[model samples]
Target: MQIVNENNLGEFLERKALKCKEAIKQNASLLNRFLNLCLVFDECKDDLDNAHILECSSFKELFLKKAKEEDGYFKITQDIKALDFMQLNFLVNQCANFLKSQGLKANDKVASFLQNSLEFVILYFACFKSGIIFVPVNACYKEDELAYIYEKTKFNYIVAEDELLAYVKCDVLKLAKSSFLKSILKHKKDFIMPKINPLDLAMILFTSGTTAKPKGCKITHYNLLFAGYFTLHQIGLRQNEVFLSSMPNWHIDLQATALMPSLRANACFVLLKRFSARRFWQQIVFYEANISEVVPKMIELIKLQNKFAREKKHKLRFLLYFLNMSNEKYLEFKKRFKVDLFTSYGLSESIVGCIGDNYYEKMSYPAIGKVFFAYEVIVANIKENKLIPLKANELGTICIKGRLGYELFAGYYEDELNTKNSFIDGYFISNDIGYFDENALFYFFSRNKDLIKINGENISSLEIENLLSSHKKINNASVICISDALACDKIIAFLELKEYPYKEEVNILQKNKELKQIEKELITLNLRLAKFKQVSEFIFLNHLPRNYLGKVRKNVLGEIYGRN
Candidate 1:
């Protein structure tokens, strides 16, 4: 752990304050224009209730203006504006009214299986506005995965995309048949929407299923409002700011970092159906994006582009992306792009972007800045069943509490045992281990469950991956523990070589030598690893299966390894 400089933090806050002032001024101007227009319309119509009509009309007018302005400049891109917010809320109200007309209550949980699109946003906001609990299923999930979530959550209504509609088979269930499915299908187009309060359950985002089954994290309007506002203030977002988001909206990064903050600031949000490394720069230039939320791997791909190829592009001012970027890459990016790179840290259960470090501040360490507003974070030791809070600079599990903290989730949907096991006192246990520096900057280590145990020794799989990544010949690697009937669990290494045999190039023999070198590197890894952690077998694959976020799915790897 390292100490954060007070002066640097103060400077960052000052800059944010200025940006906020600018945003407020712009908002005020827009509001006044709308009000003036409303006044004129009210004077001409004697029967119209001047005050009431003006209020709604003013809001709508300003919202429309903002949306139109953003659409004009940022064409052929996804940009969330005041009008999009109003429209989404209006649609949500319509949906809720429709659901209520069919006898569903406000507390009824509604599941959504859709990709990142305008429809997804509309449905999500409608759920929030109608007081229905929005349960979002991962788009990548198969039939079985979707079925598990539907059963566990006991969703009363399911709004699925046309492509995924076939997977919702209610007839397949044995007990607790969904009665609302029939009503939902019957009144799909005739459902009434409702208005909602700010304290409603906005969304339930599930955790990434890297090691185990995903857990649903319940998030409320209060959680989003607080986290969204804090992120905007921290990152210095302003009105009319153009934001490019490549990450999936289902993930916390796009939801908390890009979408929510952009909406709160009245900034433009540019959405992409999927990321294309070849067209990233062109898209950014076309949209004139000021801010972008990107993963480390995406940034690496962007950095690989030649400067001459990108010479005629529009410049970006601020980039809210991942950290731990190599020094050489960071310098090269800064010199070539001339933009500030900021980093943030949070999990799906944590409501996303809880801690962040700005680029203006010198990043000497992997510090996830000071805690955001209304979040009390502490490092705690997990011993048996009890949680003990550790002192600063002492490594332990991360515990979060406060108004925003309690909103993590009541529990994992239907997983009572694991949910009951996750809490320590009133605080939600994050299950991730890390420590805070003297200056209160948090540093993440690894997941508690991700640690592999062999012969009473605990080894981090990330450590093995990092070690393998250091080798020049190995392009990608994934380390997982395979069950050995005799030895409990044995270390298995999967290697993807940088130089692979290409039929077009006729380099099969050279590629074979490269594969052999990768094996030699594995032997060296065995020398460095502890006796129990040493690899018992090695598997060579053309490529490793990774999620859009670049995280290796060990379960998938295990399945593939078994098949081979």
Candidate 2:
């Protein structure tokens, strides 16, 4: 059976959700998870004819529709090659078969710690063909980040680039980039492809939370479709339009908005290995891309490179820019590059491009625009057990109303308490402060208030502090982000020493040597951190400044770093 009986799929997902919750509490492994591959729960076959899942297109259905198309393909600029629709679908199925060969079962999890390479994309889609859940671990995550995600996910298999194999601590089945790439191309094996339900979990994307632990957002197949369709309609994409982006494929912008939208609209996509200031315009020119994704930081970097003239003849229709930029720079960048910026706002927990600007009209630089269709956005607050909707020009919390697993994310993976707490009065409280003008145009005030966005990726200060505090020689650590002219934010770590507290001691020379050693070890740790998360500098502090409420004054830390 290529498809699970939709009637039974819902019950199965419900059971799975409960199972996940129990597993989360018990910290247990999935026992006897390798269900004999062909068991299709035939008891519910009678109820399959009128199931709603059949009405919607899963990734499998999407692939089948485009498999026969001869004109559409994804151009991987890094490899200098393109995979036509037929070959893309064929390879994806083959990857699925390869997973089956390793005893992976439906609902089993595989952690993909990879960059924006072809294998990453193929393995992701293959999970849909088979019924495994895709857990995308940040490719740049260090041993600490990797271990945390590994523990949370309880992955049955892991796929990483050959260079990153040392970071995989588990003995679970490992697939090195070179071996997997060669193996998938060899033969098409005969295997029964499980039919997928639209509501089934497709991916678990872990976004940093205010706490030390990251929150894994559960993305369903239907949510992926909805996000893509919404963004495609929002931007008014046309068939065969070439979309391009260099953001990590693990990010929502690249996957939901750029890639999925292209597939939904029957458009082509261009994948770059990473963003480059020097080659930014050249890739667009070379690829003949009609649309590209960028953040304000990237725009700033590209501007500083001043290589605009080299690829001035690029055919990019517009740049889908995110976050706010200084109006002076925003206007100057547009006038200088002669390209329109498509500004939009979204979160990992929300739909991609959930709120955005309509480029068709006169543009507003800071206003992120209104909510897209099939979802509702309201700015309000729950005061004294009552819902109070804010009027125009009134600042309040921005909330989104959408059906779970469709318009919004399913919930935080295996975190039912947070998932339950996140929703209030039928709306997902975004915890973002914003206001709408009389024109119903929404402006972003702040989202992820305690989080920092460096190079379009969100990094939680608490996560950094939690990791740094674990160092044996360090008594405590405080992290702060400072503004930069080129990079969006620069992180500075203020550490409290366990031994070297004062400089006037007689053993100062020995302490200085120990300090140098500690700094060297930290440099190694910083190297493992995603480049953006690496601290620009480290400052020794006896104690972090705290208010009477006992909260670390990060602002004070930033000030101290600047003063030093």
Q: lDDT scores for all predictions?
A: 0.58, 0.70
- Write down the TM-score of every candidate: 0.61, 0.81
Off by over 4 Å in 1: 1-105, 171-199, 209-211, 306-315, 323-325, 358-365, 387-393, 404-407, 449-564
Worst 10 residues of 2 by lDDT: 34-43
Indicate the TM-score of model 2. 0.81
Writing each residue's lDDT as its tens digit, candidate 1 over 1-564 gives 111121221122223334444544667465532221100000112232223322333223424443243311111112322233333333334545555664566668777676565555645655654567878776665566677677767887776666667777754322111232233233332233344444456667776422334567667666665555667777777776677776665676677777767766766666765666655665566556777766555666777765545434564766775534555766776687776667676666667566677434554234667676556788988778777889888999888775432335445555667666667776777777788888888887765546664432335666666667678877776788765432346888777667654232211122366567768767876665435556777777666766689776777777877876
Question: What is candidate 2's lDDT per residue for 1-564, written digit by digit as tens?
Answer: 112222222233233334434533564221211110000000112323313223322212322333231222222111333453444555666787788888998999998988777678778877866778999988888776788888888889999988888898876899998787677765483335677778889889998756566789999877776766678888877776778778886788888888777765656676776776766676666556788988878888888765544356767778887887888888878877788887788888885878886646655567887777777899997787445999999989888888888788999988998898888888988777889999889998876546777777788887777667777888778887777777467888778778655442112122367677887777677776767688887776656667799777777766666665
The 10-residue segment with the lowest total lDDT in model 1: 35-44
> Relative to the unseen true structure, what is the Cα RMSD of model 1?
15.1
Alpha-carbon deviation at 224 in model 2, angstroms = 0.9
Q: How much is 563 displaced in model 1, in angstroms?
A: 22
